[model samples]
Target: METILSATGLLTPGVEYGRVAPLADDADPVKAVGAVVPVQTHSLNVGVLTEPGQSFPDTDALITRLRGVAIGVRTADCIPVLLYAPDIEAVAAVHAGWRGTVGDIVGVTVSRLEAMGADAGRIMAHVGIGICGDCFEVGSELAVCFEDAGLGAFVLPGPFTDRLTGEPMDPDRRHIDLRCANVSRLLRRGIPEANISVAPECTRCSEIAPGPCAASVAGSGMTLAVGSEGKSAARSGVRLPSWRRDHGTTRRMLTWIRLREECPS
Candidate 1:
């Protein structure tokens, strides 16, 4: 059994490229090595934003041996995992939602990076923005699925009392910690403790909180839905523009990772 640990500020900003228009005049947002874009919205807008005539074409995870080429993975409630292998000087960004998790996409990505000569032990992992355990309530079947994946334990029949409160809690609402789960998975793969980092905030929980902070509750999920949804729905134009743009920005926001050969004892 591997002991899961969190990262402590070794990752740094490589670069940022907006997936949308008004290219920031700094670095062409289109050709950044690991750029994050909406999963939906098949538009010439994205094409135009990217470098001339260069199209990624239906890729959720992007990895590169090319330095200064930052890959990105867009997510709201889903897990955005960024991996870096210092030994090979390569990196990968993965989108692992419940569906992706069950598919073992994270493991597959690690394997892919290793195939490219990345040392698993030298890889640093970051499990970015998504729903937290306390905020994400799910069905028993789904809970079991996470357990099967080695991310969590099976929930048993009970009142599901709050561990902190020592009071009965709702049985129907069991919170799943997707970030911690992924951290466990990474540790199992031999990634060191000091190399992994997790965002302390939860989008869904923050959304439901009172006031201006609460105003953006639906933003994350909405953004992800737009990109992951098919062409018809995304192209329907019913979705808000901010959702589209924010999804693109979320791909560029905080959270980074760096793999180191010297382990901290």
Candidate 2:
């Protein structure tokens, strides 16, 4: 399993987190990994999904305080963000597809964390594995989305081949770096650079299970290990199984986080 190390060291002594690698593609994440029961998961749409009532329609993010209740989001090339707010002992799982990114989903989630009394200085975030900027080619429209994100680096020239004319297109196609874009957004919101950890893996180019299929949006959640703060974890979805890849097989790995019951201080 590809894991990211935290430079901020904000996870409560008891907090722990992990992601499903290519080989872990199984029937259920909870059944396979979570040792807890009654975990609450939601069906994700786009744009900061949430489940106030559980699997709520059009919801993309959720905040929970229930020690054993786990929340997560699914994604193919989209970014998955898990937040830990030590003060309120709450966590947030966010789905940042391109549309959601443009809508400032990260900021919204941060705001949600704040509503629960999270402090920017102590908050920890992980920019999970997803499509990097180079692998995610786009058009002039999405290319310009960088302006909104303030990550001017999000858009870049990608290989452009014209199928109809049998020639390479001019100026190249554009690619969007979803990872940097999200990181930039988080930085703008005051989440310390030290507090955010970026996954070392990239789903678009890696040979691992070649997953989060066109239809699968793999996802997961957050939690502390054992100490003064609290605990939590994240797990989530793959694309919904689309035919975009024609003959490609569909697969999705679940990434999750769980907060254990706090230890007696």
Prediction-by-prediction clash tally = 9, 56
- Residues 127-173 of candidate 1 have per-residue lDDT tens digits of 76566565456787888787786656523344454432466668776
Query: Which stretches of candidate 1 lie above 4 Å from their native place?
Result: 1-54, 154-170, 207-265
| TM-score for each of the candidates | 0.58, 0.67
- In angstroms, the error of model 1 at 237 is 28
Q: Which stretches of model 2 miss by more than 4 angstroms?
A: 1-12, 21-26, 30-53, 158-171, 208-250
> How many clashes show up in model 1?
9
Clashing pairs for predicted structure model 1, backbone only: 7-196, 30-50, 34-70, 34-71, 34-72, 39-227, 40-227, 133-176, 207-217
Worst 10 residues of 2 by lDDT: 223-232
